[model samples]
Target: MYERKQEILTKILRAGRRTYFFDVKATKADDYYLTITESKKFTNEDGSFHFKKHKIYLYKEDFNAFKSILEEMTSFIFDKKGEEIISDHNTEQKFINN
Candidate 1:
């Protein structure tokens, strides 16, 4: 008999060529933790696409500090750049859609 670990909640965000997954999972003792996964798509020389994934696990104890730093960093970026889309993909996507 095997018990499978399952995510209690999940959310996904897609940005350009990258995707972000936020999953809430439970431990054996029924404690909850969060996993943040960043998956980026890359094209090989043969024109095949593959995804590279990086994940971070956040335990309950570190949630406050993690949230604080993440908020601070994102706020700093917005304060400096004022929410500008400074990527070529943004313009390209607009042209492609129209």
Candidate 2:
């Protein structure tokens, strides 16, 4: 028998190397649904920082709509930004080593 994981009211704030993700996690009243938030962080040379957050509230009824929009947005960003290729070696190794 498979059991479902217990869902709790969670606030996940993740900070990555370049970005931050702040998610106000919640469940639907009756239907099984969830909401997520994304926050991007920017840093200045003066050691100041700022964040821009965008949230998506998803409901069970709007799953398809949400998925479609996500797909479209991701595709658009990829097409516009192109792909980033990272070289095997650290390009900034010299500066760091010195």
Candidate 3:
């Protein structure tokens, strides 16, 4: 069985009900890699809640290409929408009814 590695570095970003964790960990041979995890909170019907986590593991070799594509995609969105959180999901129903 594979054991979980300890994080050498960590960063957290909380956005509303979702929290993102960025962690840097090392392999058994001491090679470092990153893990990006998104944990979203969900409320149960009985007044309890839980978090659903999704994670991605990124290695050094793909760093450049990954960063380039991420930057390009984000820049494209900013160029078109200009950083405003306009007409998000909450307004969808209102828009449809109007």
Candidate 4:
């Protein structure tokens, strides 16, 4: 018998060569948690591409602290950077669209 985790919801965000996956999954007891995965694409010298992924498993107990810190960090960045597009990829896209 094969056992697999059930996913309640899935959301994906693609940014340049990186993709982020937010998956809400249920445990054996039907308790829900979240998994956040960051997948980045890299090209090898042999003309091949590969993906490197990092994942975080977040449970209900840590949700509040996690959200609070995330919001705080993002707010700090915005306060310092003032909504400027600093990445090369974003700059190129902005010029292309304009």
Q: Which candidate wins on TM-score?
A: 4
Tens-place lDDT per residue, model 3, 10-98, is 88877767777888999999999999998888999999999999999999999999999999999999999898777555322111110
Candidate 4 local Cα displacement, residue 69, angstroms: 0.6
Off by over 4 Å in 1: 91-98
For every candidate, C-alpha RMSD to the true structure in Å: 5.3, 10.5, 8.8, 5.1
Tell me the lDDT of model 3 at 66: 100
Worst 10 residues of 4 by lDDT: 89-98
Off by over 4 Å in 4: 91-98
Q: Clashes per prediction?
A: 0, 0, 0, 0
Task: Judge candidate 1 against the unseen true structure and give its global Cα lDDT, from 0 to 1.
Answer: 0.85
Q: Candidate 1 on 1-98: residue-level lDDT in tens?
A: 89888989888777778777888999999999999898889999999999999999999999999999999999999999988877656632211110
Instruction: Identify the leading candidate in terms of lDDT.
Output: 1
- Residue 24 shift from truth in candidate 4, angstroms: 0.3
lDDT digits (tens) for residues 35-79 of candidate 2: 566666789899998877677666668879878998999889789
Model 4's C-alpha root-mean-square deviation from the true structure amounts to: 5.1
lDDT of model 1 at position 33 = 99
lDDT of each: 0.85, 0.56, 0.84, 0.85
